[model samples]
Target chain A: MSRIHHLPLHVEFGDCDPAGIVWFPNFFRWFDAGSRRFFVACGVPTWKELEKTTGIIGTPLVDTQARFVRPASYGDEIVVETSIPEWRTKSFVMKHRILRGEELLCECNEVRVFAQRTGADPHAIRAVPIPEDIRALCG
Target chain B: MSRIHHLPLHVEFGDCDPAGIVWFPNFFRWFDAGSRRFFVACGVPTWKELEKTTGIIGTPLVDTQARFVRPASYGDEIVVETSIPEWRTKSFVMKHRILRGEELLCECNEVRVFAQRTGADPHAIRAVPIPEDIRALCG
Candidate 1:
């Protein structure tokens, strides 16, 4: 069975645009929040833990494709489902779906690659192999 | 001269993930902000003005594709350039590029469709012709 996790999110006022509908970009923010929760649920060290213990870097999204099917409004309670579809040596793909009851609101797929911090520029990133613990959980 | 407007953005701490680099998702936020400013520069109503005056609904992104060539860091000042590539009868396409000085960071293209609001629901969206005023300025 696939490791599936459910996350509940409250639409914040900042998440909406002047139209009173949740801005499309905020969907991604919710997705990232759910992803963090999924990692915690799986016993993987949270981002903070990884930073302190392993020096492991947070994965950076290389590509993302999302489709907004139904509109979500401010103050709506939404559920987000996240699952890993594929795990490779250095990169992995995650799929997320946001729903309101039976209504599908948004679907997204993201590709993230592990990287190591190097050089004087902290943002200077280079692709590295996934850590063993992450691979075990995601694989 | 090409009708392009450049807006400089400071990458905020909230814009970065635990990776210590600017999160890819935040790029869209910057794009939206830059586009809003660009429209204002072109004499188009600010997003707030449009929402109130014409009941002009905000455009919903139907599709978007972004390519990350280089990582942008928190606190980095980046420039976003926005331009209308094509204005269809009811929808339009906008192109955005993020640059750090002379180095290109990322580029994205988005398709937005005019959606009309109906009683708090946006299903009443129909492709309304681009207003001549917007076309003249954007063209």
Candidate 2:
């Protein structure tokens, strides 16, 4: 079974727009943070450290779909529940459900790939096959 | 003819990650801004103004899908091109293409609805039908 992770966050004033609701992109940010936390809980190293140890830089998102279920305001405490439901040769699917108290605020699914820096360009990135050790760590 | 609106932005240091690439969520933020700009360019009133004239509060996203094509970094100047390609009675599709020079960074399509404050709860919201005046303004 894949491990799940939960990241709790306190929304701040800057996280909201003039509408007094949390800006939508902040949900994506929380989801991304939840994703990273999931990996860390699985004993995975930071992308910076992994780059030197395994040449695996980071998981870059290729596609994402999200739905807004409810609106959240500043000062609301939210939790992002994240899990990896599927894994492929080079990519994986991450599912995130954001909740406030008993209410589900938003949800999203992301398709991301294990990537490696290509050439010497700092910005050049390419996907690499899933490493056996990493998969085992997550499982 | 359906008009397109372009909103230009400069990537800031806070917008990037340790990897020196733009965090994906920032793209959503820019797209949201572009969505607002699209209406502004078409002479639509602000949500605050419309709240008094009509019960409509704001355009809230129901669903969104995005594809990341390229990575951008701080100091990069980018533009989000937004247009409404489809309109329904209550919701419409907002499409955005984020570009840096000739390079496409990301693209997204969002389904958003005109919303109104529901009940006395400040965060409670409900979708409203597309207003004729607003639709005409967009056109």
Candidate 3:
């Protein structure tokens, strides 16, 4: 089986546009939520905990690319599969695919960077190296 | 003045996440709205009008790449700038920048293809040539 994690999502009315279909943009929110869940499952603390514990900051998206293949309507039961395909010194890449049963809805790839939040500015935060403890649990 | 078109946007509560900042995904919706307005200003009919007239469809996105530079909060009045950089027979490209005054919020480049819908299956839609009028106006 793939190392992918599955996240089941329900489309809310608010997720729809005037066209009565799930607005294309909402997939990104769902993708973000799924990533959070995956990180927690991998034994990393929640974003809040990470911020408090390591003084490390939340990962901000540096780049994102998506392709829409199908339209999803309101109330559709969708599945989001997420995985980390690449991890580097200062950033990591996540890939997501949204599907309705057998139908593919959209696919996205996102690159996120870690930064240290100073008083008023953010400084570049490097990976240094994944500590054995964290890497064992996370990777 | 720069050829940049400034479109003021309202940040709806639904646009925010639990962190109380606008989620990154909603920026695409705002970008689409700004692009629609730009097309209207260019004397190109709105997407709905084109759909009605030539059976020409709203080109579904094939790819989008975006970077989030800053966080925006709910109720913030932000401006989005959109410009068409390439107009082709089968696809067109646009670049967008979202800003809050002088602070840059996000930047995105999107590539979309003119597609023809087939039956009720959105995925079955096939990319076709850009309608003559649209090509002429955009060219």
Candidate 4:
């Protein structure tokens, strides 16, 4: 069985829109944090540390899809459940489900790659092959 | 031909991550803004105004997918071109492309619905049929 990481968060007033519900983009922010927390829970080093050793600055998404099931509002306590369901040679899929108690709020699946700075162009980045040690640690 | 709206925005310093690239979530935020801008450009009323008359709160995403082609950073002037490619009975597909000059940064397609408050549950929302007059205005 794949390991799962749960990150708990609270919805703040600033997180909501005039509609009185959390802005949709904030869900993506929590998913990003959940992704990093998953790696940390698996004994993976910080992206900054890995950057020095492996030139891997971070896991950046190539593509992502999300389904918003239900609306959530401020003062709600939510948890992001993250897991890696698939891995490829150079990319992997990270899944995150946000829930309040037993109610699912949103779910996302992201295809991400381990990215490194490319050449001298600050905006240029290239995906590198999945690191064996990192994969092992995560598994 | 479908109407296309272009929303120009400046990437602020705080928009970039430690990697110096615009974090992916910010892309979605821009897309949402672009979606609204598209409607306004088509002479559609604001969500607040629609809510008062039609009980429609806003266009809420049911599903959204995005592909990141190139990274953008602070100081980049980006334009999000938004168009509605398809419309259904209750949902529509909104497409957005983020470009810096002639360079493509990212693209997204979202399936969204006009949402209204459901019952007495403050957090509950329900998708409503696409209003004919509103659709005509957007078209």
Q: Which has the greatest DockQ?
A: 4
lDDT of each: 0.78, 0.90, 0.73, 0.93
Which regions in candidate 1 have their CA more than 4 angstroms from the true location?
A: B51-53, B120-127
Model 4 pairs in collision? none
**Residue-by-residue lDDT tens digits, candidate 3, B69-129:** 7777777889998887876678878889998889888999888777665656433466788
lDDT of 1 at B63: 70
Ten contiguous residues minimizing lDDT sum, candidate 1 chain B: B119-128
Is 1 or 2 the stronger prediction by TM-score? Answer: 2
Residue-wise C-alpha lDDT for candidate 4, range A1-139, written one tens digit per residue: 6699999999999999988899999999999999999999999999999989888899989999999999999999999999999999999999999999999999999999999998656598899999999899888
The estimated TM-scores of all candidates read 0.88, 0.95, 0.81, 0.98
A58-97: candidate 1 lDDT, tens digit per residue: 7777777777777778678899999888887888888899
- Model 3 segments more than 4 A misplaced: A12-14, A18-20, A120-134, B1-3, B10-20, B74-77, B120-124
TM-score of 1: 0.88
Residues forming the 10-long window of minimal summed lDDT in candidate 3 chain B: B116-125
Total backbone collisions for each predicted model: 0, 0, 0, 0
Interface RMSD of each: 1.8, 1.2, 3.5, 0.7
Minimal lDDT window, size 10, model 4 chain A:
A116-125
Q: List RMSD in Å for every model shown.
A: 2.5, 1.4, 3.6, 1.0
Using DockQ as the yardstick, the better of models 3 and 4 is: 4
What is candidate 4's lDDT per residue for B18-132, written digit by digit as tens? 8989989999999999998898888889989988898888998999999999999899999999999999999999999999999999999999999998765658789999999
